[model samples]
Target: MVVIGSRTPTQIDQVPSAAQIVEGEQLREQTSTGVDLKTALGKLVPGLDFGPQGRTNAGQNMRGRSVQVLIDGVSMNNSRSLSRQFDSIDPFNIERVEVLSGASSLYGGGATGGIINIITKTGEAGGPSWESAAGVTTGFNNSNDFDHRVAQSASGGNDFVTGRIGVAYADNGRHYDAKGDEIFPDIAQSDLQGNRSIDILGNLTFRLSEEQTLDLKAQLYESGYEGDHGVYFPNLDSSTPNLEDAEIRKGFSADREPLTDRRMLNVNYHHANVFGQDLYLQAYHREEESSFHPFPYPDSDGSYYFTTSKQNTTLSGLKMLMSSDITGNVSLDYGVDIDREEFDATQMYFDDDTTDATGGLVHEEERVEPRYPGFQIDGLSAFVQSEWQPTDNWTFGAGIRRQHMDVAIDDFQPSGQSLAEGGKSDYDVTLYNVSALYDFENGHQAWTSYSEGFDLPDPSKYYGHPGQSVSDNPLDGIKTRQVELGWRYQGSRWLTQAAAYYSWSNTTIEPDDNLNIVQRDDKRRDYGLEASATRFLGDHWQFGGTLHALRSEQKIDGEWEKRGITVDPYPSQHTATLHAQWSDMTRSLRLQANRSWDYADYQGDEIEGNTTLDLIGSQRTDFGKISLGVENLTDEQYSTPWGQRAAGFYSPRFGPEYLYDYQGRGRTYTLSWSLEY
Candidate 1:
């Protein structure tokens, strides 16, 4: 979604100038590593890819595409774009993170490989206030392996009214790595940081007079882990045959439940002069769901045993925007979007496991009837952007958008499955953009951009098993094209920035697991290079870093090629991260280092790459803050090229193997304590 904003200001400086900002003191300085939001944007954004399990990052990817994930403006990329939506929320309830790269989304389908809003926590500034936080993380010779969290908040107001409320809880366990072993159990995105959570949110603002204002919000997040030590790896049955010696099991007859429950609600209306423009109205609703447990393979042979794969989405939207000033240089930003979605997608099978992988239990449970019918969407959009400045640092921008969609499906066949015929699909698209900005009196700033993006397919491939017809399916929509160049400099202690990009897309979908379906790859493409620098060595050292270099190709034979996992697996393409710090006003220290990118798997063999370290510390104690973190500070244990890429189950008796290549999180630690009352 793109915004020209009328309100909803979480200070990302109204992003634009291409985009990228992950502040809030860089996510409150990690606050003890596993506050998972895709592991705090894979340790502070840079392209993206997270898999080393601190629990779950779903199916990480960003650069290889599919990136949308918002909070505060709702939309956790549901009906496909699931990277489990980064576990819905929780990264100390963020307060910044705006990244927008590639097919620059300014309001169009789920931003193709870009857009991660996330802005939470709105409080403070005297008056009535309260905050209480807690933490206790583990892994370092496993102190009974742990993770415990707690949070509470409150805020008050005046000048009309204002409000805020918050709640949080966590209690994970078992994550030993760093040679302490015990991580095994990534049962397909079920690691849920060992699961157990609850989060709540609230906000209110009503200043209905002085130029108008009305805001209300609500959020709820739930996590799960109905247990029996979840752990699985059984998609096997291509005649086994070695299959990389597969074996890592658990829960063989019912005893797993990994879950995620998300909810959101919002209503906004603002005005600072509506007749002349500057009004913004919004209505939002979101309901995201996630579930897992695909265990099946315990003597009974060939796939069959307590299955459960759920996905449910429900997003409702309404946005009305306006911004003005169309003279003396021009300015405008317009918007209109109305969305509705409802997807079901389920796969549940349970005739009652016979309990076999140790956890003994033999019995009878029954209930089976879930043949994925999912799909029921409706969308409409409108956009207009214009910003021109005649002098003083020059600037120019242009925009266009028009999208429409309607898809309906749900017929589902049960009992003796087979025969099918359930369809309906529709789409119409047109998205565009342009940008340029210049400023230089020394503190340089330069910008350049071009964009387009779209996505339609993946409503679980529109009710599955379509065979053909449905307009040749591949309506997979998904179109993206982009180009970018950026430069920045902000002196005053030292600052630097750089950007380069190119993108191409039309079709891209993957999931063959030996012909289980979903396939389409009309040659994807990508180009990258990003850079950053910072320094202030004076009042106690400080340094900053970020460097990414990607290529992500895929056209095979006719040219291109270089896209592994047969063209897209997600993770690494020359990365680099480094940060250093030393504070004042109450002790603080930080350091992080990354250096990954050297991959070749899926026959090309050679999966070697390493370099990781992290450390953080803080103290402002007097009954207040105290923190410490250490994530993979040197216990490498490699794995990142799609983690171990061999390309999971290519079939025909183990032809292309590498079912979740495992191995990645070692060395970890966390400890925290907070307060603010």
Candidate 2:
């Protein structure tokens, strides 16, 4: 009902951009902080901007660019993405979450601006059904910081076989904010939020007779952590100035259990009359791996050594689809896509003196990663879309796409050879989009759209320094242009939406927080306005709200520079969210609040803004359902505008104890229970 399913390319029944849908009964009333998906999409979506202790991504800036995290549709970044991709999985294997919000010229090339699809958990349409769930969350300033979760599933089969199986697990502890500190971990953070996670899923279907169908799926995810003491900080002499005890974390050592693993597999086939068209076919594969153990090197005789780092990413794909009906009112959809990818990194070293001048812990001598190369990519695509409705409420759509790309690099060398020894990057381009919609009989609805998207350039800038090649125009691409207008209403209880957008870019890219290095900026501009509403007060109460405003600019020295305006980025020109709910029947209760405003950082200076409040309650019975939640109810001692712009631009020039460990995990409380049959 929140705009029917979209697979675009002439399947347009509706679309004008600015789309959203959360379902899963609103993820069971917010599963008490929901446990990632960036904490349940930071309160039901709105140009996302978290980290006021809600952490997910402090900059996925939907309307300002950056977004394209999918699940059932594959692609979880990994093409050199470092937004941590909202903790991979475990929203209890989600079953809903679809947001468009901006730029999606047929869902290609980093989505240029937005698109997040997460659709999992399937199996239920006839026969046997079983679902089980569990939950726990703790914090009132430390009950050992708590976290827990468990899940199970069982689906049924008939009509020639159908199946589903699911499993889940999560564990966490150690989190403190609102003056209670504790988050100072290191190494880019992500052991699924540091320590413990597991998920597995499977599904199968084969209904041959009913128009032919076939499906298969598999997935696995893992995260873990181990530390002996962790945390170390001290003004490192950045022109010292009485630092706040180096932001505390007291420098200790030992950490040899940092891991992450991900896997995926998929297959599909459907037909409902081929030649006349309705066919669909697909194939997929994925893999991701990460590791970091003991890091602290210094050997050449002076002793003390430890290093073991690794990362591997592999992706594979294939796809095809068709849809036809051209006559009575028009219809057409087309597709063909292919992809292959690999990203690899390595590092090794051992010997950390188990007791004396480094002898007892030789640990299989090593030293392999430093200028390591290995980045590959290949892609091919084709597309077409069409839709037209001449009567009822008028609608029209258009689409086109063509993509071809190739980038390669392997052959490594030069730990010291003066530089220049790597190369490769091939290119191809063609992307397009157009839209329109209107449906009013008093219910209201209106839309308009134009889209084009692109992004590519960051193969560690050609195999990360120390000698590089391939840069003159491997068909250079990094373009974006978008425009949008929208309005919607679905009364009977009230529901509303509004949108306004504008975008321009020739390029934009960032990275350099603690120096991961990667920056590119060129004429860029972004504009925005968004509005939302929901109402129902009759039987028990209900009210909802949302508002967002944005602005981003660039062009450097020639004026027009407003990227984070002095540090406090996370795309916050203005943001607001309000919620209220109360129910009858079994029982339900909800309360939410959010706000972020107070801009001007990119050298313009001035940053400070925060407001948070949350609460959730539920009760249902027939043998299942119970929940309670409270997050930062008021314990806001805040600090998260990406940790106040990384402690106002790198804490005193890079060492104010590196403070800004997102000080806002404060007030927290949660309880959960679940079941269904």
lDDT of each: 0.66, 0.67
Model 1: pairs clashing at backbone N, Cα or C within 3 Å:
2-106, 2-107, 178-666, 178-667
Task: Report the lDDT of model 1 for residue 34.
Answer: 51
lDDT tens string, model 2, 1-677?
54323553222226667777787678657766544557557567777655433323645467767777877677677656545566677777688878777777454677777778787877766868988888877665555477788888888887777888888887777677677766654433332333677888888888887788898889888766633334332322223323245332322333334676788898878888888878877788988876654443333443334565566888888878688988888888888889888887776554333312322122343456553456788888888988788877887778888888787766555365444444677878787778888888688878898888776755644355544454632436676778888887877898878889888876555545433434355677788887788899798898988887878777677777776543212455577889999989998888889887787746766557778888899888998888888877887876655565545545544434254435557777788788888
Q: TM-score for each prediction?
A: 0.35, 0.34
Error of 1 at 45 (Å): 6.0
Query: Per-residue alpha-carbon lDDT of model 1 for 150-231, expressed as tens digits?
Result: 8888888877778888888888876665677665555444565457878888888888798998988898989887444544
Which residues of candidate 2, in runs, are more than 4 Å off? 1-15, 18-37, 42-78, 83-103, 106-108, 112-189, 192-348, 352-368, 371-421, 446-488, 496-535, 543-580, 583-677
